[model samples]
Target: MQPTLTGRRIIQPPRSLLVRVRESVDFLARHSPARFAILVFTALILVWTLLLSLPISSHARSGTPLADALFTAVSVICVTGLSTVDMATHWSGFGNALIFIGVNIGGVGVLTLASILGLVVSRRLSLRARLMAASDSNASRIQAGPVNEGQAVRLGEVGNLLATVAFSALAIELIAAVVLLPRMLAHGYDLGHAVWYSFYYAAMAFTNTGFTPNAAGLTPFVHDYLFLGALMFAVIAGAIGFPVIFALVRLWRQPRRWSVHVKLTLFTFAVLLVAGTIMYIWLEFDNPRTFGDQNAFDTVFQSFFMSVMTRSGGFSTIDISDLHSSSLLVTDMLMFIGGGSASTAGGIKVTTLAVLFLAAFAEARGRTSMEAFGRRIPRDILRLAVSVVLWGATTVAVSSILLLHITKQSLDIVLFDVISAFATCGLSTGLTQDLPDSGVYVLAATMFMGRVGTVTLAAALAASTSRQLFRRPEERPIVG
Candidate 1:
C-alpha cells in the first residue's frame, strides 16, 4: 500500500507567509476550487497592472502614460480587444513586447501553465488520483469532467489539455503568419516590415484583441487573401473555445470515439456560428453600410467573420461601427453568449448557455434528463450553467446602469458598450475614446470581471470554495 502523510507532513502548513495564510483560508472553505481560480486571476492581473503602470526603462523618451498603459495592459492581460491607445504609434518595441507577453500569459491563463507544470512533476496516474492532485493543487489548470455520465462529475484528468492549448495556439498562429506573409510582402512592406507584420498579426489574432501594430490592420488588405486569412483563422480559433479544440483533436486521433464534452461543444458552436452567419447575411442584405459594396461571396464571408468576432474575438474585416442596427444587435447577442467554458473567449460563455438550453428543453418536455450530445447533462453542470448566466447577466445590468449614468448615452448604445466591456467583446459603438477616466476604469473593471468570471471573483474575495449545487436549509421566507 502507498504510504500516506500521517505526521508532520500532513499537519504542516505552507512555508511562505502568503501561502500559509492562503492555506489557512482554504482549509476553512468547503469548496476551494472556485476561490483558487479567482484568486489566481485577480493576483496576476494586479501584478500586471502594476508592472504596466510603472516605467521600467531609463532611456524611454517619455514615461508611459498611466491611463493608456493601464488600459492597454488590462486589454492584453484580459485578452480583451478594447484599446484606449493606438498601439502602433504610442508604445516603443520594448513596451509592445511587454504587452505581447501579457497577452500570451493572459490569453492562456496562469493557472493553466501552473497546472501543466504540476501534472509533469507529480508523476500521477489513475483518473481519481490525478483529479484529486489536480484539483487540490492550485497549479492544476482546471479539473475537467466526470467521464461516466451517471457518475458524479469529477475533475477531468488534465490528459491532452496542456499539449492541446500550447501546440494548437502555436501551430495555428504560425500558419496564420505564413498565410499573411505573401500579402504583406506584396503590400510594399520591406522584408523587415513583412516579418514584423507577420509576427504582429500572429500575436494580435491569437490573443483575439483587435490591437494592431500596423495602423491599417487588415483594412489595407480587405481584398487580399493573405491578410484576411490570418485574421480569419485567428478569430475563428479564438471564438472556438480551447476545450472544444483540444477535444476535437483527441477525437481525430481516435476517430471512433469522441468525449461528451467534445461532441456537445462542437455541436453548440456549429449551430451558433451558422445561425449567426445566416442572421447577419439576412439582416444586412438591404443595409449598405456593413457589407453593401461586397459581392455575394465576399458579403457572406464578411458577415461570417463579423458574426464569429462578436463572440469575444475582436478582429473585424470591416469597421464594426458601420454595421446596421440589426447586424449590431445580432452581434451583441453573439457577444453576450461568448465562447465555451474553460476557454479563452469571454462573456457568459457558450457552455453555460448550452447547458441551460438543454435543461430548459428537458423541463418543457417533462423529461428528467437534460440530453445534449446524446449524454445526460448532470445536475451539477446544469446548476453551474445557471449560476454563470444569472451572475453574468446581473453584473452586466448593474454595470450598464452605472455606465449610462456617467456617459449619458442612449440605452441601445450603453447596453452595447456595457455588454462589450463585460463580455470583453470589444465591439464598441465608439464611446471608448470619449469616456472620463472614471468611466474608463469602470469599463476596465467590467472587462476584468468578465474575463475571470463573477463567481470565481466572489469566491476569491470570500476565500471560499464554490460548488455548482447545494441543499438549502428550510427557513421562513419573506413574501415578495
Candidate 2:
C-alpha cells in the first residue's frame, strides 16, 4: 500500500495474469499488423491440422496421416487448392466443413477478419487499429508524407475498404450460388445437395481456391459452358482486387475518376485474359489430348475458361496434363503473372508486371520518370515491384529444383507444380497427387510462404524504410 498526496491511503493495482495477457495482445494489435496476420494464420493452420488429423475428418478406416493432414490444412489456410489426396473421397462431412471454414478465413485475410471482429467487439476500430489493418490490406505501401501522391488511404477510408471487401465477397458469392444452384439441380444433383455444391463452388471460385466438393471435380462440367461462365464471372470479380472494386463502385458513372492503380489493373487484366484465351485456343485447338475431341463451340468455351482459371482461379474445363508442351509453357507464364494486387488471387500480382513494363517503356522513350495516365509512378513503387518479382521467381526456381530431385519427375511437370504452389494457383499436371510425402511437404511449405511472403516483404520493406539524413556521393555505373 502507498500513501497518496490526497491524504488518503492508496492501494496499488496488482499485475495479474489477465492484465498481462491483455497488455500482450494490445501490444501486438498496435505494433505490427503484418506480423499479427502471420501469427493468426499460423495458429489457425495448427488448429485445422489437429482437427483434420482426427478419424472423423476422413472417410477411410484409418485417420489421415499427420503429413497429409498438415498439408491439407496449409493449403486451405493459404487458399491454395493443391491437394495430395482426393478431397472428395478421402474426407467426411465434418472434414469438408472444416475445410470450408478454413477457405473462407484464408480468403478474406486474417487482418481483415480480425478488424471485422474488432468492429463487432468494440463497435469501432481506433486510429492505430485501422492503420494496422490497412497496412496489411493495402495493395502497396502508402508513403508517409505525400498528400498528392495518390497512394495514401485515409484512416476513415479504411473502414469503408473493410466493409467493401466483406460486402463484395458476400454479394458475389450469394449471386454465384443462386446462379449455380439451379444449373446443378438440372444437372441431376438433388435440391439439398445442389445447394451445398453451389455455395461450395461459389466460395471456391470467388476465393480462387479451385476446390471442388463433387467427387468428379470440374470434369463433369467440362462441356457445360453456362456453368463455366458463372464460375469465371465469380473468379474475375474476386481476382480484380478490392481497390479496383472500390474505385468502380464509387465511380460507377465516371470512369475517368478512377485512380491509376484501378486503371492499370483493369488494362493489364483485360490484356492478359484476352491474350491467354487466344494463345490457349491457338496452341491446343487441334491437340487430340485436349480440346480437339470437342466441338468448336466447346473448344472455344473451354479455352476461355482455361485462360480465366490460369489467372489464379484454379478451375479447369480440360485436363491440364494433356496440354501440349507449348500450351504448358503459356500456362506457366500466365500462372506466374497471377492476378491483380490485394485480391484473393496470388502470384506476384498484375500491378507489378504493369509497373515493370511502364518503367521499361519510359526508359526506352528516354524519359526520366515512369509516367502513366499523366501521373508519375514513384521510385519506391518500382523498387517494390522489382523485389516482388525477383523474390517470387527465386522461390519458384528453388522449389522446382528441390521437387525435381526428390520426385524424379520431368522438369516441365515439376516446374509447373512448383510455380502453381508459389503462385497459390492450384492448377496441376497430375503431379500433385502422385508426389511423395516429402514432396507434398515441400509444396505445402511453398504455399504458406507464397501467401505470406508477398505481403510481408512489401510491408516490412515499407515499414523499415526511412528518409536518409545524409546523402552519399553520386556515382554512375556502366550501362547494361
Candidate 3:
C-alpha cells in the first residue's frame, strides 16, 4: 500500500507550526545577540521567581510573596545584592543554592553561558557565532568593513573573547574558593558548611555581588583580614573586566603593547581607588561611630576595603549608617563611578569617566584632539562616554526624587539608595527592607535598569552610527 515501487521519491512533509516557530526564534537569536541576551535574563528572572515562590524554597512553612520573590530574583540575577529579605535567614538551603546558581549565571552572563553551550553543542565556532557571543557579553564591538586584515584581526579577537570570559570567571572563582576554604574551616564551620560558604562567597566576591550567606553577615569575619583580603582580591579581579585579566595573563611582560582601553581603565581605577581610600580614612578618622573606634591596622584596612567595595563590590566591613555625612557622600560618588566596562561590576564605568576627563583635559590645554596611552582617543568614544554619564546621572536623579516622594526618607539616605541601585552596588542605608512595596519595586526596577539599560544603550549607540555620504553646511551655534 505504501508504494510498491517508488519510481519517484517521496517528498518530506513541511515542519509543524511549532517547529517552524522555534526555527524562526533560533534564527532571530543568532542574529540579534543583544536582544537575545535581554530575553534570556528576563526568562531567568521569571523562572527564579517561580522557584522562589514555592513553599520549599523558604525556611518558613509558607512561600514568599510574588513581589518579593520577583525582586529577589532580579537582584540576584542582576548581581545586585539589594534584597527584600535576608538571604541567609529568610530562605532555606534550596533558596541559598538558587541564589548561588543565580550569582554564577549573572556573573558570567547568560549570553556567555549560552555561547559556551553552543560551542560545545555545535563543536565549531564561526565568525558569525563569535560576533553574536561578543555582543551578548558586551565583550567588544565589531565594525563594518571591507574584507581586510583589520577585520580579520577583530574577528579573531571575538573568538577569544568568549573563551576569555568563561575561563577568567571560573578560574578566579576557583582560586578565591581555594584561598578562603581553609579560613572558613578555621572559623569553626563544619567541613561541608565551610566548603559551601567558600564557594558561595567566592561566587559573590568575584561577581562583585554583595549577597552574604551568613546570617551575621561579614561582621563575624571583621577581624579576619585573610578572608577579607581574599575577597578583595576576588572583587578587584572581577571588577577589572575579563579583557584586562586576559591581557594581564597573556601580555604581562609587555606593558607597552597594551591597548588604550586597558591603559585608561587601569589608570583610572588606580587613581579612583587610591583617592577613595585616602578620603575615607581622612573623613572617618575621628568619627566614633565608624573607623574612630578601630585600631590603627583595622582602621586602615577597613578604609581600604571600603574604597574597593564602594566601586561596585557592595560589601561593607563597617556599619554604613554610622559613617559621617561626608564619608557617605564620597561613597555615593564612588558607587556612581562604579568599575571597569565589560566587568562584573556596574556603574557609569571607569573608562567612560576616564574618557570624559581626558576630553576635558585636552580641551583645557587647547588641544584639538584627545590622546591617551600614546594614541589618539577616537571622537566616537568620547561621545559615548558623555552619553553614558548623562544617562546615568539623569537616571539616578529621577529615581532619587521618586524614592524620596514614596518613602519620605531623607535626601541623603534616599540618594544613597538610588545610587547604589543604579550602580548595581548593593550598599544601602538600612532602608531597603523597610521600604513599602512600591518603593521596593522602584529600587528593583532601578537595579534591573542599572544592570542592563545603560550598557545596552551604549551598545546601541555605538553600533548605529552612519557614515553619511553627504553633509549639511557647517554652522556655528551659541553655547554656554
Candidate 4:
C-alpha cells in the first residue's frame, strides 16, 4: 500500500527503467519527430558501427579499426557510397549483408521509418505519427504554420504512402534483380553467386548506394549496356522520391491533377539530367582518360551514365579521378544540386534549385509571387529554399576547409570529395581512400548532415518556436 493524503490508501506498482525509457521515446516521437529522427539515425549508426567492428564481420576475422568501422557505418547508414576501405575486399559476407540491410533502412528515411515503427507498435498511425511521416513526403509539414494541402501528402493517405514506399522498393528491386541475374550469370558467376550479386546490385542501385561487391567493381561490365541500363532505371526511380512515385502511380495519365511539387521535381530533374549529360559530353569529349577512347555512341552513353551517377547514384564505370578538371567542376555542381527531395539521394535537392530559379525569374519579371505550373509558390517556401542552400553551402565549405587543413590535399580534390560527401553523391577523385582518421571523421560528419538534411537538422536543433501576437514593422535593406 502507498501513502495517500486525506483518502484511502492507494497501491502503486513499480515500473521498470525500460518502460520509462520507452515512454520517453514515445513522447519524443509524438511531440518532436525531427529530434527523434536524429536520435534514431545516430543510434542506428552506433549499432552498425558495433556490428561492423565485430571480428566476424571482417575478412581478416579481426576487429576493424574504430575510425574505419564508424566511417563505414556512417556511409552505409547514410546510403553514401564513399568508403575509406576497399569496399569490395575488406568486408566478409556478413559485413556486406549488414551494409545491405543498413542502406535499405537508411533509404526509407528517418521520419518515415519512425512512423512505420510507431504504426507497427500501436497497430495504427496516430495523428502525430501521420504528421511525422507526412513531413518526410512534404517537408513544409514540419513548419509551424498551416501547410498547403495541394502540395503535401494528406494525413488520410499516409498509410497508402507508407505501403507504396515498401511495395515500390520491393517491386523495383525485384525487376532490377531479374534483369541483372542473366547478366551476372553471363559474367561467369555461379548460380548462387549470380543470385546474390543480382539482388545485392539491385538493392544498391535502388537505394542509390554505389557499393560494389566484387573486386573488379564496374570494370567488368562497363560495356554491358543492358546491365547498366537496369541500374540507371533503378537509380532514377530511387532519386525521384517516393512522393513523386506515389503521385505518378496514381496520376500517370492525369497530368493536370498532379501536385506542383510533383511537377517541379520531375521538370527540374529532367532539365538537370539533360543539362548534366550535355555538359559531360561537351567537357570530357576529348579527354583521353574519359570519353576520348570511346566511340561516338559509347561516349554519349557513358556521358549519360555519368550524368545519372552524379545525381547521387554513386555508380561509375570510368575512373572519376581521370576526368578533366573542368569536368570535375561540372560534376561538383551536379552533385551539389543532387536529386529530388525526400529521395534516397542527398544534397540540397533539385526542388530547392527549381524554387530558387523560379524566384529569380519572378524577381526579374518584377512579379511579387513565384509562379510555376499555373500555381503560386509561397514566400515561406522561397525562404526555406534559401535557408537550405545556404546551410548546405556552408556545410560543404566548412568540411572542405577542415579536410584541406587535415589532409593538406589540393583544393580541387578536397572540394570535389567534400561536395561529394555533402551530396552523398559517392563519386570521388581518388581522395577519400587516402584520408587520415581525422579526415574520415570529418567526411563522416558531412555525410551524416547531408543525409539527415539541413532542414531536418535545423529543426531538430531548435528547442521551440514562440508565436507572436503582434507583427513587427518591416524594414528594407540595400540589395547587393
Candidate 5:
C-alpha cells in the first residue's frame, strides 16, 4: 500500500486484473442475468466451434470448414439437432465426445446452468442469482414491473428447484439408458458399442436433440416399439421443463394441488399430441412413401411417434419429405408451438399458446380477466405471451424469406426447414444438408435465437425499462 502525502491514511493498491474481471462478471450476473446468459452461451458455442474445427475432431485428419464447425457448435450448444454435415460420419471419437458433453450443458438451460456455476463458485446463491434462476422457471420475473409471486417458483425454494433440475435430468437419462442397453445388445452390438450407443441415444432423447451417433440413424430399430417408446418417454420428460418436473415430484398424487403452470403445460401437451397424431394419420395413411405400406397398428404407432418428435425430439423413422404438403403444414404448426418453457425444446413454448387461447376464450365470453383452475391470470402475463408469440412469428417469417431467396427452394420446403430451425426441431426435409454457407449461417442464427428464447433475447437487448408514473388519456380504437 502507498502512503498518502499527509500520512493520515495509506492508499490501497489497485486491484489486480483477475480481481477486476471477477468483479465485472459478478456485476453482470447480478444486474443483467439475461445478457450474462447470452454471453455465456455464445462463449460456449465459440469454444465448441474451435474444438470441433481441429483435425482430431473429424474422421479424416483435416480441419473441418469454418461454416460446418460453427454450425455444429451452435446446434450442439443450442441443443438443436440440425446439422450441415452427416453427424454420425463427419466427426471422430473426440468430436463426438465434445458433442455429448455440449448437449448436456445446453440441456440444463442457460440461466439454470449459470446459477449452478454461480452456486459452485460462491458457495451460496445471492438474491439476484435466485431471481435469475427463478426467471428460467417463470419468465414473468424478467420484467421490470412488480412480480406476482403466485406465478413464480418461491424464492425460498430456488435451491431446491436447482437441485431438482440436476437430479431429475440425471435420473431420467440414466433410466432411459438402462432400458435401451439390452435392446441395443439384442440387436447384435457388442458390449462396448451397445453401452456407448445406448447412453448416446438417452442423452440425445432427454436433451430433445435428434443427433444419431450411427450413420444408419434410427432405421435399424425402426420396428422396435419398446426402444422407440423409451425414447419418447425421455423426450416428453425433457420437453416438460424442470419446473413442471419439480412440481410433479412434490404433488404427484394430488392433481388438485398442482400449480396452474403444471396443469396448463400437461393439458396443452396432451391435446397437441393427440391432435398432431390424428392429423398425421388422416393425411398420410394412404401415402405409400410414409405410412401407406405399414399395417394399421404400425401406421398409428408411427404417426404417434412422429407427433412426439415434432415436440422437439427430432428423431424420425421415415423421410420427412415424403409426407403430404398438408401434413407438413400440420407439422409446421406443432413445431412453431414447440415445447414447455425452460426446456431443452425451443419455440414460443406451450404455456404461451395456452395463455393466448385462454385470452381468446375469455374475450368471447365477455369476461374481463382470464381464469384457469380458479386462479385469475394477470394482465402482465398475457402481455408477455403476446409479445413472445409476435417475436417468434416475426423470426420465423424473416428467416423463411431469406432462406427461400438464398436457396431458391419452394415455400413449403423452405418454410418447413426454417420453422424446424427456429423451433430447434431436427426433423428436416433433407434441405439442411444441401444449404450453401450463406444459408447455413442464417439458419444457425435462427437456432441460437430460438434456443435462447424470444423473451430472453428481447430482455437482453433492451437498454433500460422506463416506468410511467401516470396513465395516458383513455382512448378507444376500432374493434376487430
Candidate 6:
C-alpha cells in the first residue's frame, strides 16, 4: 500500500506541473501590468518577425534581415510605420499579414485585449495594470459603477474596457474595408488582391499606421468619392478615443450631455482638420509632383487626406517625398500635434492641445481662471499641459540634435523624421530608407518613445523610485 501510494504521488508530475502553470499564470495576471504590457508587445513583434521570416513571406526565397524584422516590428507595434525596407517591394503576402497585426496591436494598446481575458479567469485586475490602463485611457475615473471611492476597478471592469476597445476597433475596421473594396477593386487589382489590399489598408489606416502594402495607398483612389470618404472615415474614427466614442453614442441617444473631453476633442479636431487642409492646399497649389495638374476638387481632396494622414493615420494620396518644401513643413507641424488621447493616434494628444490653447487664450485675456466652452479647466490639467509641452519640446530638441549629428541630410528632413517618430506619425520624405545605421538608431529610439509614450516612461521611472519624497521645496525664476 505504501509503495502504491508513493508511485501514485510520483506519477502526478504532469498534474503538478499543470497546477504550477495555473498558479504562475494567476500570479502574472494579478501583478505587473506594465511589464505584462511590455511582454505582450514584445511577443507580438516576435510573431510578426517570424511570419515575415517565413518562406511564404520571401516568395519562398528566404526573408528579410533580422535587423529589418526588429525594425519593422518596432515600427508596426508602435504604429510609427517608418520602414527601412519598402513595404511594397520587400515584404510578401505573409509579411504584409504580420505588418497589419502589428498595426492593430500597437494602434490599440495590447493590454486592452489581454485584460479582458484575465478578467474571465481571475475576476480581478492587477493594481499596476489598473493604474496603467487608467492612465493610458486618460479616464478621470475608470469604473463607471459605485465603489469604495478609494478603490479602483474590479477584474470584470477591465474586461469591459477591453471589450469596448476591441469591438470598436472591429466595427470601424470592417466598415472601412467594405467601403474601400469596390473602388480599390476597380483600380486594377483582382478580387483576391483587392480584398487583401482593402483589409490591409483598412487595418493600417484604421490603426493610423502609415505602412503601405500596395505601391499607391490612397493616391490612386485620391478623388474616388467612396475611397476618400472611407479613408477619412476610418482614420478620424481612430483618432478619437473609444471613451469619446461611448460618450458620443450616449450623446446621440440623449442629444444633450457631451462630456468636456468629447466637446474639446471634436472642436479641436475640426479646427485643426480644416486649418490643415487649407494650409496644404495653399502650400501645394503649384507643386509639380504633388498637385500641379490636378483640378480644384482633386487638389482639395488630396490635400485634405494628406492633412488627415499627417497626424495619426498615414495613408498618402501623393508621394510624401515629392511634396513641396512648404507642404513638408506643414505636415511636420500637423504630425507634431498628432491624435486625441486613448485613440489609435499618438502625440501629446488633442485634449492636451485644447487645454494648452485655452490656457494660452486665458493668459492672453489676462484671466485668472482658465475656461473653455464655459467649463473651468482644472489646475491639475494645466500642470499636465505644461509638463507635456515642456517634455515634448525637450524630446524633439534632443532628437533633432541627434538626427542632425547622425545624418548629413537637410535639417528640415531630420526634424520632420524626428517629429514623425516622436508623434508616431510615420509620414516620411523617403529618408527613412536611405538613413545610415546611426540615423536608424535615432529614429528607432524615437519610435519606442512614441509607442510606450512619454507619459508611460515618465510614470515608470517615477513609480520605480521614492526620490521625489525628499526633494527640497521648489523655487522658480523664469523669464520669456
Q: Which residue pairs in candidate 2 have backbone atoms (N, alpha carbon, C) closer than 3 angstroms, thus clashing?
A: none
Assess each prediction's global lDDT (C-alpha) against the native.
Answer: 0.70, 0.84, 0.82, 0.90, 0.91, 0.74
Q: State the lDDT of candidate 4 residue by residue for 144-172, as single tens digits.
A: 77887566467799987887887898999
Native-vs-model 6 lDDT?
0.74
Can you write out model 5's per-residue Cα lDDT over 1-480, one digit (the tens) per residue? 564554676677788899999999889877787788898899999999999999999999698999999999999999889999999989999999999999999999877977887887888988888988988877777768777756747777888889888889899999999999999999998999899999999999999999999889999999999999999999999998888898899889998988888889999999999999999999999999999999999999999999999999999999999999999999999999999987888878999999999999999999999999889998788999999999999999999999999999999999998899889888899899999999999999999999888998899899779987999889999997
Candidate 4, which ten residues in sequence have the lowest lDDT sum? 1-10
RMSD of each predicted structure: 5.5, 2.6, 3.7, 1.7, 1.6, 5.1
Report the CA-based lDDT of candidate 1 relative to the real structure.
0.70
Residues 1-480, candidate 2: write the lDDT tens digits: 453454575656667799898898778766666666677888999999999999999987579998899999998998888998898889998999999889888988888778877777888878876876676556453334443356534556888787788899999999999999988988999998999999999999998999999889888887676788899999999888877887788888998887888888899999999999899889988898888887888777788888899988998766789999899899999999999877888888888899999999988999888988888888778887898888888888888888999999899999988888888889999998988888888888889878886757456455554778999999999988
Cα distance off (Å), candidate 2, residue 166: 1.4
- For candidate 6, list the clashing residue pairs, or say none: none
Error of 2 at 304 (Å): 1.0
Stretches off by above 4 angstroms in model 1 are 1-33, 54-60, 117-156, 253-256, 461-480
Q: Total clashing residue pairs per candidate?
A: 6, 0, 0, 0, 0, 0
The TM-score of candidate 1 is: 0.83
- Angstrom error of the Cα, residue 368, model 6: value is 3.2
lDDT accuracy of residue 328 in candidate 2: 89
Candidate 6, after superposition: displacement of residue 479 in Å?
2.3
Most lDDT-accurate candidate? 5
**What range of 10 consecutive residues in model 6 has the weakest lDDT sum?**
143-152
TM-score of each: 0.83, 0.94, 0.92, 0.97, 0.97, 0.85
lDDT at 9, model 6: 73
User: Which segments of candidate 4 are over 4 A away from where they belong?
Assistant: 1-12, 117-123
Q: Which of candidates 3 and 6 is the stronger one according to TM-score?
A: 3
Per-residue alpha-carbon lDDT of candidate 6 for residues 396-475, written as tens digits (9 for 90 to 100): 88988987887777888888888888888778878788877777777877787777765555544443433345778799
List model 3 lDDT by residue over 370-449, tens digit each.
88867876676676677778889888988888899999889999999889998988998898988888888888888877
